[model samples]
Target: MICLVGAGPRGLAVLERLCANHAGENELVIHVVDPFPPGSGRIWREQQSPQLLMNTVSSQVSQFTDESIDCSGPIRPGPSLHGWLQSHDSDADQGRRGPDDYPSRRLYGRYLRWVFDRVVADAPDTVRVVVHRATAVALEDADNGQCVTLDDGNRLAGMDAVVLSLGHSDTELTGKERQLAGFAERHGLRYFPPANPADLDFDKIDAGEAVGVRGLGLAFFDVLALVMEGRGGRFVPSDKGLRYRPSGREPTLYAGAHHGIPDYARGRNQKGVAGKHRPRFLTADAAHRIRENPEATFRRDVWPLLDAEVRTVYYQALVAQRGGSSAASNFLKDYLSEPDDPGTLRRHGLTASDEWSWERLGQPWRPHEFSDHATFNQWLLGHLREDIGHAEVGNVDDPVKAALDVIRDLHKEIRLAIDRSGVIGSSYRDEVIHWFTPLSTLFSAGPPPLRVEQMAALIECGLLQVVGPEPQVRTDPTGACFLIGSATIPGKQIRTTSLIEARIPKPDLKHSANPLLCFLVETGQCRPYHIPDPDGAYESGGLDVTPRPYRLIDAAGVPHSRRFAYGPPTESVFWFLNETIRPGIGSMILEDADAISRAALTC
Candidate 1:
């Protein structure tokens, strides 16, 4: 029997691919384990709000690797909110003129559960796949095979391979984290975890209380919905977003970050493109041009574009100063007041760090056009080490020299940003605070009326308030915390507490989180951009201030012993470094119970 420890999309996917791609002459049997009732885990089975939608459109969500239905282009082309629901109605509602908006994550979860059921049905007669609706408490490898101990004190017999397709862990509220909980606990504080999309008990809170949110990221938007619209708040339209009216008394929202609010999100309001495209600020050629001479290129082209994107605000005595102007008659008011210059904002609003990244994405910002963009980031920093510039490093706990490494260089910039904010403070602290927040990435894709409406309804209902902006957010003293995106660990920081160890069925503990490492092994990437951690049974890299070892060795040659990590959960990147939350990717996980069974028998 092949044991698939976590039966979320990834586990199902690994099972499906093995079944579809392998010579299944020897029937495969899959022993799928999870605490949730079959089909999906808590992340998918629960944690959904009716109003909170998947970030991606429906065409992009599938559960198989080889069986993909093309999604014409990157700019959202698929079944939208109306299209999905229209299947129930007459054909007339299909073309109704409205926002072809995103749908709730709950609906997407339903899609995943359905796909899992279909996989279970199509397996060969020779395959015998049994799903255990119990938690896997312990796992260890034996010479004969792998032994998996379930929560019920029963140990499943030997298996050829074990796969961890787990999902996000419950947020273990720390002392300080609890202090945040206490804020909403009393004065009727409503707590919102950035990771969860579940419907919180916003009703426990009446209107007129000072409702505060811990992080002003996307989760904050979901919380904004639960209070404003989900409960009873009504949505009214506005240029900035949908305004809300309390079905009862409204509460003032207290949104605090180290930097108040981000300016990058909300998107550009420019109209009448230069030709057809929305201004080709950056493309592959732009990257190539900058590659020729990094510093000069940044000062002229790159710095100008990004600087225009930044929003500056310093509430010196609450005058609501914006971008160096002490007035805001309206969003359009500022336009008429200021001269129509292309790069003038770069001079007044853009700060030093802004200048730093200005060169990062380069003048032409078509991310899809360039692949080796990271090389440019390393080169721009003056190539700290001559022999190796921006190359990978190994060694878990050994210190890496900051003056000579790419990872070291990035980490150094992170530390400097943290320290500078601590001392002199960033010129555009509020902009940086908002940019780094989860909201920055989520809304970066695009925002529709539905989401903004949800927030507005909460406020109008007297259930939400517009707590003014913050200048910046600081890392935990150690900086081990992280910020997330949908399917990537784009952001990293050292925090007060981090995972130290993990226990998996296939006990070849290894660094599994670095997406690059996963791709190298060809085992599979973690579905939904997160490493599985059911029951917190996996090991992790220790929380040392110094950088841990990061390596990429051939899996076949790597020894499977206690001293080394077999696959993720043992090395520096154990559980997904998924600071970015991209849950919509779950539907594409394939399910093949038979392949898992055969792998258990042979490999």
Candidate 2:
């Protein structure tokens, strides 16, 4: 018997494998636990907001290891994206592509839940599944097996092994964190902690409010999307690009991340983006150059090489047609389309006359013709009829968002390293890990962790009015909510009363400040697959577990087994989420069920 914690995707995957991969008619009882039932979907996919899009494409999101195994699709044999979509919608057969690229994250969540249910239904008679609608608070060991403690009074007494599937955790607050809020208790502050945004009661919020958003990143974008698109109208990314209409009265968002002003760049080369999954641009020349330069940091040694390659790949397709008369016409159109002011002609502004174009370059197929914000905007409006509204969009991507993307991509690179069994603690490994580790809790931590700088910026701007510097106090926008001292970033650790059980970060090695930091400002549309990430924290090998709400404790007290755990409150632990489902547990249930079936086997 085993216990699996957290009913998220990873937990469910383990459970499915347990049942399907088992050979003999061995009896095993699997315990699945979570406040939400097995199918409620994890934080990332389970969404109340339709506007929130997935980071990965649907074609890339199946549970199977093989890309060809497309069970997540609408049909079994429909491994290719087109086949599956056409099967689901007969009308899709007429089109080359139909809403298949980056489908909704909300839809993907539903798909995961359905898969979980199917695995349970098809389980062998030798197996029994149990689900606990509770959080696993603690892990204890006793006697021959392990003890799994649920938040409620109940407990699971024994288990052989626990495979942890805990998801990302929240990043916490640090120094001078809550002072701004505490100081402005009499006034107001807008501290929107990362929680279930839909669960919030928006009516309580006043209209025509001026708010200062702490981070100018995707989370900030989520905030904006929620306010604009979620408030009323639907959000859709179309041929026209990101479009948003009136969502009641939009708030005046005052966003201030570390990079106060975002730096914009000319659109990068698009040749790589044309490839299926975006090709890696690790050239021999660049590698040699990097290896040769003694003082080479990635910025000095590799960026220029990558930049040139990306541009080459991007413009290569257009070489033939670029010399045509339309090129001049397009250039004229680009100039004529812009507003009189040069500042208004920038890429970040949603309305900027930029674009994504396609033309039959004298060679094979349709090659891209234009690649700038103005051209992209024009293409979308003319062809797709979509437009993303930005009151004052930055020059390039919001710098903080770009930084996070770098960190996120760095994690992918690290995964590649792990897959190759690459050794760590080397210059490269250390460089990469530094970017990813900080994001673990954000990827999993409940009641999301805010950075110290995020906290400081709010306080400095008087957006979050401060009270007690050490022991903080603050007031919410509508004056309906008030908070005690929460820490600020850099030293976002503070101890006070009210709301969450706030704890300060310890000055241990785990929380030591990383000095080798690079504020990578831009990752143009043409970023290479190999650049090191700035936001990635640490890369460890033990178990690539998420920063889950539950804890993973080794069952030292279980006398029979060497390393076993009762497991986290696995969402689908009952069937087979932790080390494959077995058909035995609470011995009597297995004995009786097996005995009845075995005797009937004679018939």
Candidate 3:
């Protein structure tokens, strides 16, 4: 018997692998545990609003096995998500979508549920799947193997193995956030901690009330849509751009992030480009060397390869887009290579605004340049419009846009390099995982272009204000409102009755509030994952796992082969974990499931 916890997409992948590998009449029983339905998971639940859209295009996602995937047994192939939707023959507006169109997340959720049902129905007669719609709160060693205790006080036992596939963690508020909540309650003001934007209650905020919203990424877009469109506003395209018609029910919003850098729009389809960028310099082999080396630092060993790949693609695209004009492209390259150098700018005949734009492009918060709110707002408007232009032309037609696309493509190779336990050096792992990955994600994997245009329109219409970058909030002395300030606009301040942190909290095992995680940590069954420091100390973060078979490592330093872990909790071992799984597209989730299933079969 095998127990797969949290039956989301990762859990479904494991089941698929297990079912595919079953050969003879060797009876196998797999139990799936989750309060919600399997496959679609909580993040992509069907109940979410239609206004919430997936960042990925229809053709980019697949629930089926494909030729590119290599499993331990015979292959099981089926339709991709787009193919499945087409097969349904539904006439709903979201249905019958094209390859390039971004489907509503609710529609994708339905596709996931369909895949789940099909897999279960087609499983071999020798395999039995039992799903338990209950939350697992604890796990421990049983006489036969292991046991899982649910929140309802029932316990499941006699499991041969357990695979932890806990998806995104809806983290508890931090101490600061808790304090903010207390302040809100005492002062009779509204305060919401970080949560899925779709899950937030927007009705509590009345029309014309100023609300301070933190972060300016994809979540903010969701909030903007709910507060505006939910209030009977409509977004219509005009000759100027996207024009917003308000319903006189919108709240006044003060929004910005640490860098005040709104995500770049999703690129238009590049004609003749069939698939993702094929890395010339940063290949799997190049990344393999870093993986094999015990002491290779990310900055010293890995970043150069990535840098070379970016520069290579940028120069190539520039020359190709400029009709093979190497001389002009070369000058432009020199200008980018030394953005702050006046001599280089002069050589390229670039204007002051051009130089400033390049500087701000590299570092989103060049604080010295903007004198006040008016100037900063002007620069932001121009910057977003120019970026939209590049996105409109398609990544291939614009070299800079193409280079950003290539940065996203690098994720696959990066995942392959780090997925192996103990392959990455500790410091390099910390630097890459903590710093570089999030920053790159902000720029490359942002929301669709239409959403950004809507946000800009919201800013222009006075419904939203761009509170300068890195805005921090605190309760005012009288405890009546929150005082918000930003470093860019020193001394100046804004006050609001409500505050909302508009970003997803990072997953950290040490601070996790999940009942299961707490129980596991409190006991000796599992512990926070740790890596060795240069000074021989240890730095712990995620859940520790054994290298090859991906078993959980306990506090006493024993590998629990019968209890494996996958998904976000294993980030320290796998570097990146939040991506949507796609067949033949470097699907690390599938690779992980295959390995775990192979181990379970042996047990």
Candidate 4:
């Protein structure tokens, strides 16, 4: 028997691969374990509010391994999310269910369930799949095989091998968070630590209450949706564009982060599933060379190639927009030959201001110092309007969006350069992880354009207030509330009774709230991955595992032969574990799943 824990997207993919590779020579019993349903799992569970939508368009997401995925296992073609909706005749029923449309998370969960059912139904006669709708609490070695204990006090013994595909997991709160929670408890305030937005109880926050939100990423938007539209508010077209109609049940949200701006809106989808930016400068060979280097750092070695790649696209799009397609081709040829020469840019009618700057793009609010909240809010509104304009132009045609889209497209190559101590560990931690990753994410991986439009409308409607840049939140003992201010705009403190941390908890094995992970570490079944640095070993907060099959490594540094782990659990070991598998791209998700499935089958 082979056990698959956490039946989320990754688990579902692994199951698909296992069936595809099954020889059918012997009986195969697969046990799938999770507290949630087999397909949607915790985060994407079908019960989530339909107001919470997927960031990705329907055409891009797929559960099956197609011909695009380069794997040793057989290709199992299946419908993309859009195709599935069409197949079920639900596309027309659900308004705006086109290929480029952002489907609701609940709808996506339904798709995942359909995919799971199809996979199970089409399994070979020799394969038998049994699902345990209980969390796998513990695993132990059992006489040449393994045994998995579930939360329901049942045990499945004699498992050949087990795969841990635990997706997003709850993490222990940090010292500051703990202090905030303690203060809130003492003073009768509400403090929510980092969590999945869907899990948080929004009703606990009183209507018209001043609530301070800590992070302005995707989760903040979810919070915005829940508290505003989820409470019966509506967005109707106005002379000013989308105008928000208040529900009066909405709480006033004071949201801000280090940047004190929402994540950049995703460029409108012009390119379909098959269209992707082909890297010219940051190619596979270039990434390989950087990976092979002993002293390579991301900023020093990798960023140059990445910078060139972005500029190449940016300028080519600029030229194409101005001159023509033929001129753009000639410009690319010349730019490839003399990438550093400013004369080429000059000849193409490009100025220094037209040059791409990731730093500038990331921190657009850095240059200005707002005197007050109103001044800052006005500036922010203008910024959001400009961003929406660019987004409306679409990712393919817009110069800026097309350039930024390179960051998303070339992520695999970037991962290749940084994963598994490819770059020096110290630089990897400080430069790549702390610096570049967040900036790149802010630029590329963001909410849909419509969300940004709504955000602007909310700001105009005076429902959501951006505190300021470089936001700082702390407990106010005197006021008995949370005091949120900013370093950039000082002397402007906003006090609130409710404080919600609008971000997911960072994965830390030592601080994981999951009982199985805690048990694994305490029992020495697994250890946290550490990157080697000259100063000291940097703890990565991810499970240490071997390459390929990703066998879990123990405290004594021995790889467990019968165990494997992947997805968010092994985050720092492999970069960007949360990204879903795209249909046409050679997705690392499918490749990793295929590897683990093949290895597990061998047992």
If the candidates were sorted by their TM-score against the true structure, best first, what order would they fall in? 4, 3, 2, 1
Residues 179-264, candidate 1: write the lDDT tens digits.
Answer: 54454344332444334545245555556554445444455666666655566656766774445556665444544332222112
Q: Model 2, 1-603: lDDT tens per residue?
A: 767666666566556655654446778677887666574435545545655544333343444223222222111111223224434443211322333343444555555666667668877888777988887765555675656777787878876654445443232334444544453344443444433344444443444454444443334444544655455643334453333444455443434333221111111112121112122443443354454543344334444433333322222222213444454344334434542344422332223222212111111112324332233223323321110111012112222222222322232232223321222223334432332232322221111111122223223322232221123334444555443321321222222212221222221212222110001002110111122224442232222111221222222211222222122221111111112111111111112222222221221
User: How high is the CA lDDT of each candidate model?
Assistant: 0.37, 0.36, 0.77, 0.89
lDDT of model 3, residue 530: 62
The deviation in Å at residue 487 for candidate 2 is 22
- Candidate 1 worst ten-residue window by lDDT: 496-505
**Candidate 2 local distance difference test against the native:** 0.36
Candidate 3 lDDT by residue in tens digits, 13-71? 89888888877888999999988888887788888777788887777787666667666
Model 4 lDDT per residue over 168-248, tens place: 899998998999999999899999899999999989999999999988889988999999999999999988899999989
User: Looking at candidate 1, what is the lDDT of residue 209?
Assistant: 56
Sorted on lDDT, highest at the top, how do the candidates line up? 4, 3, 1, 2
Please report the TM-score between candidate 2 and the true structure. 0.51
Worst 10-residue lDDT window for candidate 2 reads 516-525
Model 3: number of backbone collisions? 0
| Model 4, residue pairs in steric clash | none
Q: What would the TM-scores of all predictions be?
A: 0.51, 0.51, 0.91, 0.98
